[model samples]
Target: MAARVDVKLAELGISLPRPMQPIANYVPYVVTGNLVVVSGQVPAIDGKIAVTGKVSWSVSVDQGKEAARLCFINVLVHLKAACGGDLDRVRRVVRLGGFIASPSEFTQQALVMNGASDLAVAVFGEAGRHARTTIGVPSLPADAAVEVEGMFEIE
Candidate 1:
């Protein structure tokens, strides 16, 4: 039930931040059948990017990881909205896609994405374990250090 999940989130000291509106034309998430496909989210909090710039250049690997975490938190904000405010509707975290803004030589993308991956497990237990892809890119919207998107199975 969402109550349990809400309590868990509270216990974890995570209060879902306000959902960010699409900076472009796309909607935040689309529900088709049982799946909610979320749009990519950058590490924004309080309507501003929490971290920016290329990883391992101006940003450290740890900072990249934290940015990934912040992005996931933003993902949850929309995911909850897509679920009609009942997070319990989510049955599983099917997959996560992460894009790390980093130099061409950076190779620690997967490790940095662990920030989102780990939090998913913490929130959904076994259901949070998911297939994932992590990639390096030259830049992202707002020049955030990381961006994360997700696919969720819902009921």
Candidate 2:
């Protein structure tokens, strides 16, 4: 486990919760060979969507970005649990794909995704940095403000 991750998480007042199971057909994560694919996780906690609605419309861009941060936290929780709660087991983050619910006019998807990308680096240092994409969409399940999925290289 990396001490920097713990330090950053504490500094940010962030706590990773228990890993959650999928609500429907798909699994939360699937590990194939050295790659781990985490399903899209919304801004949820305790089986409830933490934030809902479209960015810059029903929700502010900042709020939506925070929601994106939470989704990334959830992804890390799942990853840690799968690897026996040891971040050292993760070699690196491969890709981060983010989906934001926003109006047609919203163009701050990249800025919103900074929350996730920033957190990843803060946690895993260089290994946490990865290729990423931020996409806008009409709506998401549970009407979540943001959703994020990830791929990681594991040891």
Candidate 3:
């Protein structure tokens, strides 16, 4: 039987891709005590970067939001692996950090991060409401429009 979260994802038409492998010398997630800290995730779908470049410059706000959404989906993928393939083990979404690659003049980082935040709530409901920090950066790995990292409390 599929986990309830899996069913929810399906209902939302979200098809999680295979968890991305680390491009550098680091693991995708780290488990410490009862928490899993996921490394920053970019908008990679089907083993390719789906969105790249600076937000509001090379990428539009809507595209950046979609990239953020994909980043969260990737975070969930790492979280599922951390929980041994069971997302139900998650107790709470502790925090999420978002990095938006934008031009120096761009200032809608928070709005762009809403893409991931909204999905978090949709998937985890109240538990998904979490502390978050969003920042605009000049660039990110692969020039991804957005990158998201998360901390999840697990049983």
TM-score of each: 0.97, 0.92, 0.97
Query: Model 3, 95-119: lDDT tens per residue?
Result: 9999999888898999999999999
- lDDT for every model? 0.93, 0.87, 0.93
Model 2 poorest ten-residue lDDT run: 1-10
- Tens-place lDDT digits, model 2, residues 1-155: 55655667788788888666687799888888988898999888887898999999989878987898889999988887667667677889999999999998899998888888888887888999999989999999979889999999998
Candidate scoring better on TM-score of 1 and 2: 1
Q: Give candidate 1's total backbone clashes.
A: 0
Q: Is 2 or 3 the stronger prediction by lDDT?
A: 3
| Candidate 1, residue 1: how far the Cα is off, in Å | 9.1
RMSD of 1: 1.1
TM-score of 1: 0.97
Off by over 4 Å in 1: none
TM-score of model 3 vs. true structure = 0.97
Native-vs-model 2 lDDT? 0.87
